[model samples]
Target: MAVFTVVNETDLAQWMRHYDLGEVVDFRGISSGIENSNYFLTTTRGAFVLTIFEKLTAEQLPFYLDLMRHLASHSVPVPDPVPRDDGALFGILHGKPATIVTKLDGKAELAPGPEHCGEVGQMLARLHLAGRDFKSHQPNLRSLAWWKETVPRIVPFVDGAQRELIVGELAHQEAFFESADYAALPGGPCHCDLFRDNVLFAPAAPGTNHQVRLGGFFDFYFAGCDKWLFDVAVTANDWCVDLATGRFDGARLTALLRAYQTVRPFTPEENRHWRDMLRAGAYRFWVSRLYDYYLPRAAAMLQPHDPTHFERILRERVMHADASPLCN
Candidate 1:
């Protein structure tokens, strides 16, 4: 979590009063995100996630809240923002946008097995199906034009080999998608960042079907219009495993794709583009990490993550291009 802001009890109480959530009994800052200041608030009412918007503008608050409500209404497992007695989804707290949401129960599935992958795949398919009818029309953040702008900013940060590979990969992806065959691929809203951390899973119970159940989806900051296949590719990159070297895992890929295809079968064109999309997804993260690497970071933070983690994943993806590990 971005630790730049100093949230205090007074700020919490004032924010809660705006929503008429009774007096705040206690609150603790949650340091688990990179873009916002989150606090777990305990009041007479119950526990809730109090988010003070740090990076997003006030104008964008409606879109984020409404999108969460929309997805939740569609049976998507996401944190629905609690409306205040005034019917406001957000309130001002310490000169920053703040909202309270019901805290979802579950832990981050860091090392998801095949069962977890299957559930995630099914949920993504459902998200795509549900999102097709969502009326909102937010601009795509990772569109081709955006990539062109972002790549240049990150080019200087990458090593020689990575820079060369990324440059060639970008051109290849651009040209491949420009073909007529790709013109008709289905387009819809997608959860652009479905990383493992963003997905929460409930634990299995004894004597019951011990399967990884969907918990809640957070971080909609990147949700926007995009290719349905791109979402699939992102999921593959997040869940797939490579067993031989244990460097990459494709088992989750098999489970996820198989489960997803059972619900929404990929067309031949989408099938052909899956590998390319996976490669592109890896590169996308690589670029993002590189950008973060070069950018200035706030000093007050817990366990700063290395941007090169994604870079390593990108290299592994490029090296295994011929393996087509997920095809099995």
Candidate 2:
């Protein structure tokens, strides 16, 4: 529920007519994302997520919509865009690209234990496998070139020590990717951001036995072609924590990796580079935080998140040799 701008009922009504989703029974701003203004729309027909693209341009909408469709068609649990009566996937609302999605059941897991970690891991691996054949022309935002371009933008904002570390890490990441041996691993589309909040878990009935299930794959805005191993590393950072300082979780990492490997076993080379990939994931978020921290925030009407939180995580990752015990 990231409410950046107010949506008038008239504007919403017009948008709904475009999709013919019936009258909006009730609607309110949702605050679960950073890039868009989302609202849970309850209509006479049913419930849906209405997203107003805040940061994405019109040209980028097709990539996201197609990706969602691709995943949904492949049996990956994701919110598929509900097409309009005219078969259009997007409608202009408040002069922004707007679309409606089926509301998925479940809530974000606030405190994920080992079991939850294992479930998430298995689902992520399945998602990776499902996305293996997706054909998209979009550039990978986490690619080596993107990292190199982003480093200079974030360097000045980071502290001196963190800056040096990032510089060194950048070089290491470059070397890791440039090596001919590293070029032979599996590659495909990946969910670049799989933070805890992005995952959803269904409510369980009292005394009923049930396994944790995955829900909506929201925020596919950052998703694109990337290394499969990097996706695992991002999951480790979100699901793993240090119990001593509440930093990174080791047990959760083990469960997650175990479950992920059960679906798609990692190659020997992928296993060898797992630790480095985890380190790179930590630094990726670190740099993103630095960018947000230093850049002037848009004062329009969006929620501002603290970039220091990720910076703290980055510092904690720097202290460990692998950070993820599961890599072994």
lDDT of 1 by residue, 1-328 (tens): 4545677766655556667667778788887786888887787887788888876778888876887878888988888899987898887776888788877778898878899889888888888888877787886677667778888887887789778876887897789679875686787888888988898887766677856667877887788878888888777777774523325555667889888888888888787676667777776776666655675456422444565655566666666666643554
Model 2: per-residue lDDT, tens digit, 1-328?
Answer: 4777678888776677777677778999986666788999998889888898877778878987888888888888888889999997887777788888888778988788988888788888988899878887576676678778888987876678778888988888889888765787787888888878778888655676656666656677778777888888887877776534427565787899898999999998787777677777887877766665676467522444565656566666656655334532
Each model's lDDT comes to: 0.75, 0.77
lDDT of 1 at 318: 62
TM-score per model over all chains: 0.88, 0.89
Strongest candidate by lDDT: 2
TM-score, candidate 1, is 0.88
RMSD to native for every prediction?
2.9, 2.7
Candidate 1: segments with Cα more than 4 A from true spot: 1-3, 20-26, 205-207, 242-248, 297-312, 315-328
